[model samples]
Target: MNKFTLLNGLVVPLDRANVDTDAIIPKQFLKSIKRSGFGPNAFDEWRYLDHGEPGMDNSKRPLNPDFVLNQPRYQGAQILLARENFGCGSSREHAPWALEDYGFRVIIAPSFADIFFNNCFKNGLLPIRLAAEQVDALFKAVEAMPGYRLKVDLERQTITAPDGTVYPFEVEAFRKHCLLNGLDDIGLTLQHVGEIAAYEAKHRAAQPWLFA
Candidate 1:
């Protein structure tokens, strides 16, 4: 996981609502436990036609032009502007893995699925919840200008528009701290290493018989 103190990137407008985890990353690609190598297949069905393993045959995998991600203008986009209930359905961590692999660092939506939202932090992605009206404004800007970019400052919790307008967003204190320090669940637990070691040493001395 990487620290997410701040992020500024081109916004890819995905106006659809209720985007489920399966659509983000199809189940067939879930075989790999590692987080890498899923970006190319991020939106498998939508990103490529012939609807099968992308690596199996290059000729079989044809990029879908209609898909928002397939659009050349949206290439290298690191921020996603989407509608309500984004990342809904299933608790698969692969959703965030695909998004992060696809170079999306922050996703701005009116709402998100509870599980997917929680998983974003562990994989170094920021799922920002904002008012529906604010999200619409961002969508409009990106729609009007294909490569529209937004500047996000996590420390100030503000998003600066291209024209210099700034909007504030809310994030929990603990989540903010973890992202700032690049602390995933394992990283978070390791924070108490000294205390844990001290407790183990005392316990071992008190229960030598148990150790034996």
Candidate 2:
């Protein structure tokens, strides 16, 4: 996983609520064991009119021009401002995978599904839980300026807008530590490599008969 110390990028306003995991990546694209290449099909159903598959012709699919993500100004958006109950439904890890692949680093919502929120951390994506009022304020600001971008400083737990408006957010200490250090489960385990090796050596010496 990559370190998420800070990010400054365009904000894409997804005003809808109850966005489920399947809607994120769809069920068909779940066959791949690898995490890469899922970005192209991130929002397959919404991004294309017909079903989209890898290597399939994209010219045929009619895009919804009105969709916030389809608009040119919102291109390359890294922060997503969403409504309540974001990332609901099935506990699919692919949801975060698709989001990260599509270049979304942080998601700010009034609330999020417990599973999806947890999945974001494992995949190096930041799911920010903010109050409804705060979310509404962010939506307002982003809507007021189409290309509005926010800079999120993970270390300071602050989000700064282009107009110098800053909003503070709360994140768990453990998650913050992991993200700052770029440590996944395996990376965390490896942190105790020296101690683990010492313990193994002592155990082997103390129980040679068991190994035989």
TM-score of each: 0.86, 0.86
Q: Pick the candidate with the highest TM-score.
A: 1
How well is each residue in 118-155 modelled by candidate 2, as lDDT tens digits? 99999889999889998998899898987799999999
Best by lDDT: 2
For candidate 2, what is the TM-score?
Answer: 0.86
Weakest 10 consecutive residues, lDDT, candidate 1? 51-60
Name model 2 segments beyond 4 Å from true.
Answer: 54-60, 190-212
Evaluate residue 2 in candidate 1 and report its C-alpha lDDT on the 0 to 100 scale: 91
Residue 42 lDDT (model 2): 79
Evaluate model 1: give its lDDT: 0.87
lDDT of 1 by residue, 1-212 (tens): 79998777988988899999999999988888677878877878887877766356534578889999878999899998888999999898999999998899999999999999999988889999999998988888888986799998888999999899898999999888888888767766899999999998899999978778
Candidate 2 root-mean-square deviation in Å: 4.3
